[model samples]
Target: MDSPVDNANAIVRRHRLSTRLWHWLNALLLYTLFTSGLGIFNAHPRLYWGQYGANFDHAWLELDRFPGWLTLPGHYSLALSRHWHLAAAPVFAFALLFYMLWSLTNRHIARDLAFRRDELAPRHVWQDIRNHARLRFPTGEAALHYNVLQKASYIGVIFVALPLIILTGLTMSPGMNAASPWLVDLFGGRQSARSIHFLTAFALVAFFLVHILMVLLAGPVNELRSMITGRYRLPKPRSRAVP
Candidate 1:
């Protein structure tokens, strides 16, 4: 049997160097994209469906002017905001593409993020949700793997949300529309794509907020250290009573 000290000192590699690099880089790019996107949204705070929209058109969703503090550069500069947003777009897009390719080639997505068949059952999902609601986290060997909910959330963000956001963004680009009119048609029109992009941006923001909250709940030090050094110290397993 291992000594307590040995067990305490024991560490497991939880993340790869490339994964860590991409994670942090993506975090930075996302923050830039979100904030600057807000700045751009401030230029036109209304969302409309179909092809065209203007000051006189009927908008489906409209909001009061966003304060300076809520926007990038802390001021109204549509031109500057567009520059920041557009510049970050390609870098962000490429980073996501590289990460996806790496994940696929390494089988990380399949091994880690994919839900097992059993995990898809309603009972299992409900149990996981209950555990999470109770603030009960995995321990020991169980902590080595992500929970079903985590897997689902990660997969959704990686395979669905990010791709949708990227494509909708491309659809909104005039040059892209010129190059591929089919892209615009796929989304119904430029305005629809713009609305989708705005909604998806908020979805990402919601994910980020919940991610930070979970980290704090799960132990920020361990979470941060794992991402930084790829070493994670598993929690002690819960004891079971004999039947």
Candidate 2:
């Protein structure tokens, strides 16, 4: 076993090349998709739940158009927005698919992201939550692994949010509806899928904000270095006080 002193000083491989690649790529891709998506939404700020929706159709949720500053082109151009969104969407979806396959083959998912049986226990999860609330972070060897909360969020984004957003995006496509009618049926209808897509996109944005906050709280330099270079210095353990 490595000594604590040595462990604290050791520089270790924290992220895989694939993980870093996808992380940066998504940083760009998601930004484009999101901004452009907001622009597209500006054309119709209302959300509905049936096959058809338009100016006169009743909507389940409605909102004032997102501001120009918050959208792609920084102006109202649905054509340009759709162009940006369409171009980026395929790349983002395919990259996620490839990353999923690669992670599976590399056992990154099983080894890192998979939840342990013990981790799923209510007491264990509650403890993790409490620790996070208190801003307690792992140290030394434990810092090399994700806590339960981290694991859960990563798994949720990878498995649930990303795929659902992709399918919902496809469901909104008239061409896709012709090709895969089941996609629309899966989510109920085009409008329903659109609503889900909108909600899921915001969910991802929420995750990203929380993720950034965690990185900043944990130590931005170390966190950013690990993601960028795949090398991380283990955080030194807190010393026990003499009793």
Candidate 3:
């Protein structure tokens, strides 16, 4: 397709239809999983390693139960929380798989998320960090491209964090353990898998918070409109003097 009105700084297509669909779907599913998972955790707010963890065991970490507002059902009920989590888990996993395949076929992963060699250089990476610290956001054409930091974070969340969480989650399940012993062995044991799952879940929560901050920092209206409508108005080009 031809470039949309460069001189006028037109509302160019920013996100693809598949991207928009997956983004909203993921938001809803993740919210459900997070809240319900919290409710489940309220039953046992402790983490341990190895094969077994009980009240008698020395938990590496222990905490009070999450507040009612932060959990699903707004009450302590492990069984109900498990029901909500189990129902959402398969759907979330399948949606991620579908999104990954679709992104690959569309070249979205390769073209947008892949890191270029130059971007990995220490000097370049530091410069991007400094720019972000200074709130020196990209404009015009530059805004359309994913910077090294953006690419790295997106790649980490999608390829590494999401997959790890899903696999570790399955490893903690008795049925999954029975059906695929190797999966359990891969994570060392059920207790270890449980610890990893809890950690990964919070890591995703951190990412979500930062993602929201960036959206607000970079103009939520523009960022959100781009995601929802697939169109983004290009910021005016920054003037520069050539030596």
Candidate 4:
């Protein structure tokens, strides 16, 4: 027999062990990739859409070089930046591949991240949007499953955005280009691929920022604890009045 306090505080296993490991590992790899990438970008702050681009050429997008504090190595070194970026690339790619395969095999994607038909309705989506805007999060058993918006975002990132980034990255690689000329053609050119890569990176960054903000708004300590450990404390259910 559990008291009200005990029941409210009861913990549930939310994430699997493999999912927890993958989450932290992905976080570390993404941090290294982003900082190192910025260091590389500092060397070339302009983006173009063709095979060749230089300081003399006009760029569709341009930004000032990022400061040392914002980059890996903490100094301007294109060579060092490339070294860091390349070193992290294989691990990140492999981890993503492994995670996707594991998730599919375990049916975690189907079980946890899949959206129901009703959730895809315009009315339902609008409701979810309004709920999120109002900071009205799911409680109790509902907390165990991701809301519709969360499912859509996660699916998009995992399926579309991640794969596009990887493909664009390979398109920018000289060795990869040599091996598969089709990649360059697919993206239009190296510079185009670079532009796409930058866009995708920023998209991921935006996602990360929103994710952190949501966690904070939802209860950072509880959210962080769930990811750090497998246990999550569900919000207590609200009582409803009967007529």
Best by lDDT: 2
**Higher-scoring candidate on TM-score, 2 or 3:** 2
Query: 1-243 in candidate 3: lDDT tens per residue?
Result: 122337436688999999999899999989989999999989889999998999999899999999999999798999999999999999989989999999999999999999889989999999999888887788777789888888989999999999999999999889989999999888888999999999999999999999999999888998999999998988755555643
* Segments of candidate 2 deviating more than 4 angstroms: 1-3
Full-model lDDT, candidate 2: 0.92
Candidate 4 lDDT at 81 equals: 91
Q: What TM-score would every model get versus the actual structure?
A: 0.92, 0.96, 0.94, 0.93
Q: Looking at model 1, which ten-residue stretch has the lowest summed lDDT?
A: 1-10
Q: Model 4, 1-243: lDDT tens per residue? A: 122544555688889988999999989988988999999999989999889898999899899999898899799999999999999988888888999999999999999998989889999899989988898787766778787889989999999898888899999889999999999999999999999999999999999999999999888989889998889997865544633
Top TM-score prediction, candidate number: 2
Colliding residue pairs in candidate 1? none
RMSD list, candidates in order: 3.1, 1.9, 3.1, 3.3
Instruction: Please report how far candidate 4 places residue 197 from its true position, in Å.
Output: 0.7
Superposed by TM-score, candidate 1 places the C-alpha of residue 232 at a distance from the truth, in angstroms, of: 0.7
The candidate 3 region of ten consecutive residues with least summed lDDT is 1-10
* lDDT (10s digit) by residue, model 1, range 1-243: 122433543588999887899889889878888888889898899999999988899999999868888778689999888888899889988888999999999999989888889988999899999988898887765777788889978888988899899999999889999999998899899999999999999998899999999999888998899999998987765445734
Q: Which whole-number lDDT from 0 to 100 does residue 172 have in model 1?
A: 87
TM-score, cand. 3: 0.94
lDDT of 2 by residue, 1-243 (tens): 133767885889899999999999999999999999999999989999888888799998989999888899798999999999999999999999999999999999999999999999999899989988998787888888788989989999999999999999999889989998989999989999999999999999999999999889888998899999999988876676844
Candidate 1, residue 133: Cα displacement in angstroms equals 1.5
